[model samples]
Target chain A: MLSINDIHVQVDDKPILNGITLTVNPGEVHAIMGPNGSGKSTLSNVLAGRPGYQVTAGSIRYQGQDLLTMKPEERARAGLFLAFQYPVEIPGVSNIYLLKAALNALRKSRGQTEVDAMDFLALVKSKIKTVNLDESFLYRGINEGFSGGEKKRNEILQMAILEPLLCILDETDSGLDIDALKQVADGVNALRTPERSFILVTHYQRLLDYVQPDQVHVLAGGRIVRTGGPELALELEAKGYGWIEHLPRETGP
Target chain B: MNHSLTLDTRLHDRIPHLPGHRLDWMNQFRQERLAAFTTTDPGGKQDKQWHLSAAAAADATDPPHLDPAWLERYRLPDVFSLVWVDGVFCPHYCVREGLPAGVCLKSLDELSDAELTELRPDLTQPGLQEADALMNWNLAWLQSGAFLRIPERVHLEKPVQLLCITTAPVGLVSLRHVIRLGRNSRATLIHTQTGQAGASGTTGETTAIWLEQAAVLAHYSLQTQPATARHFARLDVATDTGACFHQHHLALGAARALTDIQIRAADQVSCELNGLFYADGNRQTAIYTRVQQAGSQGITRETYRGIATDKAHGVFEGLLQLQPGVRKITATLQNRNLLLSPQAQIDSRPQLEINAEDVQCSHGVTVGQLDEDAVFFLVSRGLSEAEARTLLSFAFANEIIGKIPLTACRDQARQAFLAALPQADIHQDWL
Candidate 1:
């Protein structure tokens, strides 16, 4: 239920994403594989409404609403989530406090009452188990002094709790070990529903082995160079992104 | 403007009636301090040591007597409380009728000759003879004060609050507080000094703390003076062998506020100092801390956070000194400040004097606005701009507030601190 048409994005007068178009229907998991500096993270930031990204052209529609015009908080209220590649460490705000505030804000936007402490605790406890994080994380500051793996797992734990409609995972597997990557992939897999969608952006195809995507798109030089079934990821993994640059320009399905 | 003449004139008039006038040694001490005040400059501008604070602007005229209804605002139940109104101890407002045994809360005038002699050494400690103008001024014109003595091995579960409320009109109110912790005693002291909003007055406060061996004392200084009021506060602490001292100071705002704190630790002593200061409008706040670890194995840790908005200014000067003979000493001093507006200013100076090469000493200072990435992250998580700022501000001050031993006091501290935030309409709910 998301549509993007020829979006041209730039940062500091330098073109990053040049004329990109993509659409995802309900319940579909789309994987965007690209090399470094291919604008994978830029796309996630633009969609999440982060400041400093200049969108010179094109429109993005989420459920027929203009997503580009909404503020970052408004976008979050509308069920768009982006898991950061480098999660910020806020020394004073606890992870649990953030999660509760986020959940309540979302609920308030949707005309729902705020969650009480007991129910919120129960919900957080159950969701934390999915990422193998203990309850102590609830009291500690958000990602403050957390290990690399624990931070990734905490991001996944947040995803599980927020239960957003469209989840954008930006290199969530970069710092994770194989076992941690499997756990994160499993956590993402379990959250998949007929009404939910995901856009997994990664440079490596290793994560694809844990949670196979419904569609794999190869992004090279800031544009979608190739689009195919899940086998495309395997092909790229076996042959690397160098061969995709030699292919013809019009390779998208 | 120089205040030496006006201060000297006032000291001459009030020397006869100052507290402890009946005691010969106390009078001699007062006279010596008065003589020092006439010679030394309070601002230290010649040495460039008071660059941030520049000058002491407190008025030296005698304040118009005022007896306002301020006790109701600061009174908390079940704790021994004392009230000082406009630098005068208010016996009618004090609540110490049935204090527990081994606990003594008395006005300086009420101390017996024996008690005075026993506490004279601590009261007349060399640190009390500091050459600082503010210290000398406080000693010379000190009009009212309290003497708190926690007997040996006495443990106080409840806090003892000293509320100093200023309602003086266009003049200075000078006072002193003496806290003596006997050997192995444990106590908590909360000192709150507040003035009428926008009142044009000055408050000079000095506190002396003496901790014997194995004694522990938690001291909190909460200052919420008006934007038009000028306040000068000095705290001197001395800890014997194995004693521990925890000091927390929170300043909201004033026309100009200056704080000088110095602590000396004996062998195996530990000191933790935390401070949070907020300045809004055109107000200014400055805190200078000097910690001397004279004994081996002594530990000193200090952290200070400041928030300045509008054209306000904030300053922090921290110095950690390890004596030449001291070894195995560990000290850390950190100052972090946030400027909410471009015009706001903050100056931080963290210094270390490690005479012993084997000791470990570290200092860090940072000055910046809100983290853009952190604010954006919080906003993307559905918090409004105001909410995100409030959350960050709360977190910045949470470390200091968390050290409050009493939950009720902690909550009050949090509320008062949040209410003073200039960034947003910060509420206590976020905290």
Candidate 2:
């Protein structure tokens, strides 16, 4: 139940996304395919409520709430998760510690019981195994000196632990090798269900092979110029965004 | 009442029973300094290097008045409490039988003539140059008292505590503290400085203090000066061969303070210095240290770290000087700081002066704000920014806290450090 209605975004006072609209209902996956500088990451950052972004005009409603009004932390506590393209490294803060604090913060906000140290260790260790990350990774400063693959796996590990209602994967497939990409895609696919929705942001059609989207929208010039079923990804892979110029731009959300 | 105080170089009235020829080196050193005190200003125009700017207006004679109306109103450690009122010992307020045998816990002022003479062979030598404040300023108008000798080859496994309560609300208060720990002797001294709230609940006054050659002294210097206080303390420790000096500086509530601490290691002696300071509010602290390796085959290491919040400023300047022919000397200084506020400042300067090529030396300095990537990485997992920063501080403290060597003391200090923080940031899962 995530909706983006005429979302126009600007970063550093320059408009990056002119006017974009997308909606993900329950049980469906939507992928936004675009070339570099196509406002893919900007859209995700705007939805996540990163600062220094001007909406100018338009509103995004997530599960029937004014999403723009909430802080990045508030959005997170409300079950909005954004798996960053580049996970940050926090020296001196271990991965496990950050995960537990976040999990507890969200759980506390929801009036739910939080997990203790023993349960958290037991829980995250299993999640680490899924991401193919060693337990030592959890002991390190958050992303401090971690390899590119390890950072992505850490993002997936966090997603597994938080279990958000809606997750926005912003270019998570970038810089990931084939095997790592498969593992990440598998992690995303494993979490998909009728109750949860995902907005998969990527440029390639290969990830779509493992994570078949219910709808594939070809984004160009800050707007979705073409929309079609999963087959559209395979067709566009054969063609490219260069051919999207011939397609008619969608008029409405 | 006006108090006329001067740097009285004559701390002792030429003792009659003193050893005439023995300890000639100490006698000659003091004579030379005493002769030059009038003409040569060893401590020239006051500079920020000594952090004595607050004392520019007040000459050595103008001592900050000592009155107990303030300190007597506050809560403090009740063990062997002693109050130093404007270069005078109030009294040893409490005497605990809990002290171990062979431990002579007496303030310099309280020492009898015989006891003073026994220690005078070294104690009366001279004051320290760590700040260039003359011995007369300290001994002449000495405000803070002392924790004296623990005899040779004795182990006082228990602790001997000394609390120096500064009650003077204004002006300068000179402190002369001399601790002489004998050969193969061991003892723990808890030296604390406490301040009180202002007359209208604002805060107390700043203080100028120093601690002299605490040879073989295991000290814990804890300061809780008031928020409205700006103070400077230089703790100089000169140790002999086969001696150990384990010192820690814990600063909790002081607006602005600096502890210029130095330790000299004679050959075959072992020493470790662990200094911790938290600069919150507009609090600023600069720690400048110089460890001179005058003797061969010695070892020393120091870890200095602090957290700067609000508009606070934190500094660490560590210098290791290895004299010529002083080989096999091992030394390392690690300085780390966390800047919470965007405006907070952290500066680190680690220096090494090596005369011998066969010595080992390592130094590191780091100053960084709360890690943004770390915050995002943790937040993506579910932690708030606050949780992320708090956890980062924990990890930083652990790396240094582990180097404390003493288990019980380390644990106690860790608890105090944690209680002052926002929260337990590093989750048990991370460990």
Top model number, TM-score:
1
What is the RMSD of candidate 1? Answer: 3.4
Give one digit per residue, the lDDT tens place, for model 2 in B1-431. 21111222232333122222234543454454334433334332223433333323132233334444555433233344455543345553445566656666655556654655576534544423432443333333332356556667776666655555544445455555666676677677766665554411111121222222333556776666666655556566666776777777777655667676666777777778888777777777767777888887878888888788888888788888999888888888888787888888888888988889788999888887766655554554555667756766766665565555555555545655665576654434234
Angstrom error at residue B198, model 1 = 4.0
The deviation in Å at residue A86 for candidate 2 is 3.0
The CAPRI class of candidate 1 is medium
Badly placed stretches (over 4 Å) of model 1 are A111-113, A251-253, B1-17, B22-32, B45-78, B112-129, B423-431
How well does each candidate superpose onto the true structure, as a TM-score?
A: 0.91, 0.71
